[model samples]
Target: MSTYMAFVYGILYLLFTTFTFVFEDAYGFTQSNVGLVYIGIGVGMLLGLAVLGSASDKIAIGMAKSHNNGVIKPEYRLPALVPGGFFVPVGLFLYGWAAEKHVQWAVPLLGTLLVGIGIIVSFMCVQTYLVDAFTVHAASAIAANTVLRSVFGAVLPLAGLKMYSKLGLGWGNSLLGFLALAMCVVPFFFVRYGERIRTNPRFQVKL
Candidate 1:
């Protein structure tokens, strides 16, 4: 899951690294205005965090109640990934193509909003799931996740210029969108197999 988040975040940051130049070159915005253009994304991120924060707890608690043991597995925190996975890819495509086509600047801004929403939703889910799954070692799990996320976050953006330069924003981001589409399967995989993996002796042996 951390691996999944790493790539998703890296892909999102591609826009983070590139959008300022996009606004200037495509939308004819000055430096000061570029910051203002990001407000849509900021709002979208907050909205996602707010909605998912409440929704995730509700879902986990509801599922826990349904369990005969009255215990919630970490996987219960993952259903939100279903929607989150969808949002990232769709948002990427929307923003990428809108910017590439030079449609109304607002169109791309709307796309950025979706991207922000997807990113925050996914981020929260991953963090919560890790914390639950590794209760005694939650800090270690989170530290590992954070380290990998940071590595990818720092490294992937470095590729942004070459990627956008060669593939153009549309296809470059489409490549990321497709990668995100592939990652959508990860949550389901974890949900179905997580308990087994956690309990498996060989798995623990490997660890």
Candidate 2:
């Protein structure tokens, strides 16, 4: 689940990094204007982290309380992904097609904002889930997740130009949105079967 979350994060970064060019070419945004637009993403991410990060803990505790004995399962963290899963693709679709159609600049910017919120929400949930699931070996789990997503982030941008050129922003981002949509299944799977999966002997680690 963490790996899949990282992969989506990679795609989100790819879309974000390339948006400068997209804004300039498609909407004729000046460099300063583009920078201002980017501030929206930063602000969105900050708010998302603040809200969702704390919410995850509250949710886990609530779930634990519901269990009578107050034992929290890592799977409880996954419900946070629900809002993110729905919004990420919606934001991507809006960003891509709005840009492609040259809709009002605010339209795409709103999409960017949603994308920012969605990505951070998903990221926070995944990180929390991994830490809760691998209490003793969380460092290794996070390191692996970081490495995989970093590779995707580094490499995927190289194709951004060609992808947008051939497919146009609409289809290119739609492709990404579709991928993100598919990744939503990861959390659902974990929510349903995570405890059983964690019971495997291979997952056990000494502190």
> What TM-score, computed on C-alpha atoms, does each candidate reach?
0.95, 0.93
Q: What is candidate 1's lDDT per residue for 74-191, written digit by digit as tens? A: 9898989887877888888988899999999998888888878988988999999999888878999999999999999899999999999999989988998898899999998998
Weakest 10 consecutive residues, lDDT, candidate 1? 198-207
lDDT of 2: 0.83
**Cα lDDT, model 2, residue 128:** 84
lDDT of each: 0.87, 0.83
Candidate 2: where is the Cα deviation over 4 Å?
none
Q: Which ranges of candidate 1 are over 4 A from the true structure? A: 205-207
lDDT of 1: 0.87
Candidate 2 structure quality by residue, lDDT tens digits, 130-203: 89898878899999999888888888878888888899889999998898888788878888899899988887
User: Model 1: number of clashes?
Assistant: 0
